[model samples]
Target: VALALCVIFNNSPVGSAISLIGMMLCLAGIFVLQQAHFIAILQVLIYAGAIMVLFMFVIMLLNLKQGENEGWASREKNLLLSVLTGFLAIGILYKISQVLFSVNMDTPASLPDSFGTVAVIGETLFTDFVLPFEVA
Candidate 1:
């Protein structure tokens, strides 16, 4: 919601870039909440920190200006689309939550402690997924 506001209210390229960075940070937080700490940290470092800085630099270099108010910029249509997308997202999350909760119907037990240390992640990436990691 806050991301949407940042993107909408901000017309400059730098503003858009910053808004995108905020969105990436939000996604990284979600990843962390889902127990994907490695991915979350990588997301923050790569997307929010490095890529966003590059994007801002490019935007500054370009010196782009926002377009003037063009015709057919209907607020009603935008509002409708926003509402629809919100409902869709909510529905999808509800379905995912239902499936996740249902998985433990038989035996409700805590998930085993998974090793999420940087060393363990580095070992997996360098050992098993070395080729893909290098390619990426």
Candidate 2:
């Protein structure tokens, strides 16, 4: 949407603002899916709620209009760059999905007694390097 605002939509502030809202909503959804409910609430509250209202105020304060520009980038160059970027993004997404789908999930029959206990971590940190710990 950022690219679309700059290139396709010719830097329309309204379009950019809509895109920002959409992006923030998606981010909040991702946070919720990841079980980070608090962060998701914060994302919506801080970004979509407060920040967006502030952005709209700024945009209005600037008194922007779409018709005139200060000789922005050429449409042809922007189109070319956007196309190349799209291709690169597609390739990266493909690679990432391939890696993610290849993960193997296996559960061990028995667990270590102190796999992630705080005492075990404390012993490793304090006993293994007491001098370094004290120096820090």
Candidate 3:
């Protein structure tokens, strides 16, 4: 829904960026519901926070006015772009269907005892990423 709203608010760059951030937050919520706390946090921090700030900064810097190039494209160019977009959409749908049909929908196996635990994560982080962890 938020993604659809982003498209609907395409005329306003700031509004579209806000809706895109909303979509990112929705995805983060989904990750939380799936018991992926670390991924959810990273999603919120990286995408919704940093990337949205950058996007908004760029949008403000551009200072684009509405309908600045409303009549710039000729009818032939519009038709060509429409056809290209259609083909791209068709290709994406085809790829999605292929993946859907190929993958099994079976229930996943249970997680191990130490899987996703704080102790295990901390130990691995300290061991494998000692320099980076210390640097940060």
Count of steric clashes across candidates, in order = 0, 0, 0
Model 3 — TM-score against the truth? 0.52
Q: List model 3 lDDT by residue over 1-136, tens digit each.
A: 5374444535688888888888999999998887777778989999999999999999999997787756436565557666767887899999999988998879665877777566787888899999998997
User: Where does model 2 exceed 4 Å of error?
Assistant: 1-10, 67-74, 105-136
Query: How much is 8 displaced in model 1, in angstroms?
Result: 9.5
The per-residue C-alpha lDDT of model 3 at residue 118 equals: 67
What's model 3's lDDT at 26?
92
Ranking by lDDT: 1, 3, 2
User: Which 10-residue window of candidate 1 scores lowest in summed lDDT?
Assistant: 69-78
- State the weakest 10-residue window (summed lDDT) of model 2: 1-10
Q: Order of all candidates by TM-score, from best down to worst?
A: 1, 2, 3
lDDT of 2 by residue, 18-132 (tens): 6777778788888877655666887899998899889978988898887765554678767876797798789999999997788654743555766545567578778898898
TM-score of each: 0.71, 0.55, 0.52
Best by TM-score: 1
| Lowest lDDT 10-residue stretch of candidate 3 | 1-10
Local distance difference test, per candidate?
A: 0.81, 0.73, 0.80
| Per-residue error (Å), model 3, residue 91 | 23
